[model samples]
Target: MGHRHKNKKLGILIFLVVCVLFLHYCTIHDVVLRHAIYRMLFFLPLVLGSFWFGLKGAIFVSISIIIPYIPYVYHQWNGFYQEFDKFLEAGLFVFMGCLLGYLSEKQQREQEARLKAERLAAIGSAVSQIAHDLKSPLMAIGGFTKQVTRHLSIDHPDRKKLDLVISETFRMEAMVKEMLDFGRPFQLQKTEENLNHLAAECIEISLPFAKSSGVDINTEFDPEITVRPLDSNRMKQVILNLLTNAIQASSSGKIVSVRTKREKQGVALDISDCGCGIKAEDQQKIFEPFFSSKKEGTGLGLAIVKKIVELHGGHIILFSNPEGGVTFSIKLP
Candidate 1:
């Protein structure tokens, strides 16, 4: 990579010098130089070169083509006209160069985004496989540890430590399973279902937690709308995660709202909480796997939710305002 970079720099430098020399030679032209049309035409290419190679390349090309014309700029009015024409021509070349450069830059960015998405997709598959492998063993381990605890004498010095291990292992196992499901791409288990029904179900399930946290839960759903080809269970999990996170982030007695409605793309689900908003710097990193600002947070919840939404041919956009709140708008097709 280092060598390649050096070579690129060297190549650009050589091209600049050669162009400069060529412009100097053009200035010495006799009959050919006297022709205004030919002289302006010569610099057009240089203008384009500047656009491609940036200001330096254009400058080099201009010197090569325009240096020849500079003397004529004052000598003959016809020559001046020719110079003006050539100046316009060079401007066009530079404009063309800029257009091309802008396109090239835009293309590179799209390619990078696509590649990143592909990489994340591949990693998701691998994570699913690893999570699957760990599930059975984790269950077995938990069961064995429980049995050991029961068989051990009540006064055993290792009891508390062993129980803690067992508890943590179970939690880890659940988290791993959650990741597997989130990253795993499965066939669309599409069925006709009511969007309002799903939202209501999730609310009921999460009510206990809401009561404990003192965060009020509000819901809005269109009952007449029908949405299908969705994994309701997975969608429920995503809602639960988002709402729970909101609760944790909010002060007691705050309000967290979940609203669902039909959009042109599909269904729009907005989950907003009147909690402390995520910091600007942290916002971009929020969806990264295993990243969390909360104490005792696994950090994988949002990552998993993002994957699940994407896999469903949907998108999740997060926004926060100075009102001290975060809103996650999920669009699903």
Candidate 2:
């Protein structure tokens, strides 16, 4: 897709350059009129560049036009008045490019943002309906399976199978809950709370999972950090999601670390793991809904984490650790 777009741009650029060359070299009895038409024609490429590629592209196209135009202007120079007019025309090309480029870029950004919001809304609605429909049936199945398991002897062959069924049912129920959460709007109940304490609590909650995964979790909390306004429950969800992911990503005996410290903006929380890092291309898409790299992942975990963080007027950043694995950092303001 990118290559196709580039090719189209290149084709248009070549066509525009051809027009300019033809105008410069073509024979004409009316030289003054021809020059006027040639100057006006320059606006086509400038306008296209502004709309197609924004400010830098417009500037680049304007500069490119000037290169071919300089020699023509020198050849057509009649006197001081004509030369000055030509230079003024060139100046206007640049000024127009900048103006059009800025407006075009702003419009493009607004359009993209609107489109994204619409897409997410559609996805959320569909997912909510599906999850709601499945909720009752899933509960019934899990409940009945548990009843069946209770009737079986502890060492019965079917008991183990029923236990697996129950585990899977619980996992599906969690995914459904995630869907509902993503579908609904966030209502933050903010209060002053210590970020360091929050991180510690989340770490403690994740301890069992970390231990099961044979991953050690370490923490560092800065004493200078103070309490800040946050929705404690939602923030805990974010931290726990990230911690769980880190634990899952690490191998046996690997370490996952959580850190909190004072920052100029507010406070920073970091979660790092010693597992295989994400591929470069996939990193940008990780926070996007339903974009997990895991085989059995519902892919809503990080998306929910990002949404909660953003609701608190904070942003999350991700990067690969130099040694191994990925680090997720959240900055609260």
Candidate 3:
């Protein structure tokens, strides 16, 4: 796609250069009428550039046209009135380009936004149906596995195998729950809550996982950070999800840190890890639904986190740590 776009731009540029050269160099009788006809032709490239590449393209093409025309105008210096008229026409070319470019860019943005909305609607509907279908069977399988595991003696040869089955069943159930949560619309139940306390609680909840993974969890809460309106449960989910991901990404004996700090907007909750960081190419798509770097990830965790944060009038930012790993910052307003 990128290569195709580059090629298209090159073609347009070549065409524009050809048009400019023709206007300046073409030999014909009746110079004034000929120049007028070809000058009007400059608008074709201006319109094309504006529609294809927005303001920058329009401005660039207009400047390119004007530069060559300036030399031609000097060579064809007839009178003061003629020179003034020519310069006015050049100014009009730039003005037309700017206007067309602005309108084109606005149209493109509106179209993109509309398409994104339609795609998300379709995905939500499909995910809701699939999650609903899988929910009951997953529950049944998990229940039966648990019952069978209970019937078996602890030292039985198949006990460990049954436990593994139970574990996998639970994992699938969790994935299903993630899908359902993502498909549903967000309705934030907001109340004023301490950011520091919330971060501490999420860190505590993630402690067990961190320990089992041989990773250490750390926290730094700013004393000056105050309470703010938040959907406590949803916020907990966001924090826990981010913390768990950080812990999982970290190596043994590595540290995953959670911090809360006061910011100009409101407060920021940051989760940073000392593990291999995300690839630069994948960073932009990290929060996109069903886009994951993990082999077993459902890829909905970050998407849901972003949704919940935005619902509360906040935004999430991801940064690559200098030493290692990635930092996810939830900034609230």
Candidate 4:
């Protein structure tokens, strides 16, 4: 990357030098040739720079093209008509540079976004197939293990092995489900639901896991929350995934705080955990599917949460620091 940047900068410098030489030649030639060539040659660098290096480069080259013309205009101070014509030409050069540069940059961005969307769509299709193929066999294995475990007493020698098989199989099934969820379109069943009540319910459901991990859950909710239309089940899934992550990230004796508030325009939910905090690089890709920092993570939890939030016309904000921990804030309209 550094080599490419250096090469690009060198190319721009060479182009600037070439523009200066052209302007000098025009100034020293006949007035007719000077005016004709200036009208044509000066614009080449402006358009080229704009197309290559965008707005800043285009503006710089435009200024460089204009500076050399100043002395030429003063040297041949013919009349007001001549001077005005020269100034107008300069203005047109700058205008074209800015306009073309901006349009070129915008078009490039739009193209990049389109390509990214296409790639993600392809990935989703592939994941859907793979997850579907694995689900049926996984369910069968889990079912057989469960039946065998039920037949054996808890104290039987083989019961523990069967129980482990069942446990691992369920974990695998959950992972597969998450993959399917990620690869499918997020559909919400919306209803008018109490935000506070749903949050409390999820917290209670996670209590056993929190106790086993020796983490305490602290919650602060606004008393005057207005019931709003949302998908209660999907929202609960978001809460569960985040809470599970927080608890798993933190060590024993750490505290996880879940907070809810009624914003002026919408409702806000935040979950904070006192973990070691996410690394700088990891934070950027936290919501990207299949990008997980955890050894056992499938990397679809936060991705699915983000999809569900967007499906409901909401947004999520995240903050993290080693000293202060990580907080995920979800806002809904």
**Which candidate number would show the highest lDDT if scored against the true structure?**
2
Q: Please, what are the lDDT tens digits per residue for candidate 4 over residues 185-270?
A: 87778999989999999999999999999999999999999899999999999999999998998899999999999887699999
lDDT of each: 0.73, 0.89, 0.87, 0.85
Q: Which of 1 and 3 is ahead in lDDT?
A: 3
| Tens digits of per-residue lDDT for model 2, 1-333 | 298997798579658966876776684635778767777887888888888888977988888888776676677668987578667877888999999999999999999999999999999999899999999999999999998988999999899889999999999999999999998888999999999989899988999998989999988889999888999999999998999889999999999999988888989999999989999999999999999999986788899999999899899999999999999999999
2 versus 3: better lDDT goes to: 2
Q: Write the per-residue lDDT of candidate 3 for residues 151-213, one digit (tens) a residue.
A: 989899999998898899899989999999989898888899988888888888888889999
Candidate 2: which pairs clash? none
> In the order shown, what is each candidate's alpha-carbon RMSD?
6.7, 2.8, 2.7, 3.5
Candidate 2 weakest ten by summed lDDT: 21-30
Model 4 lDDT, full chain set: 0.85
Give the residue spans of candidate 1 off by over 4 A: 1-102, 125-133, 148-166
Model 3, residue 39: distance off in Å is 2.6
TM-score for candidate 3, please give it: 0.88
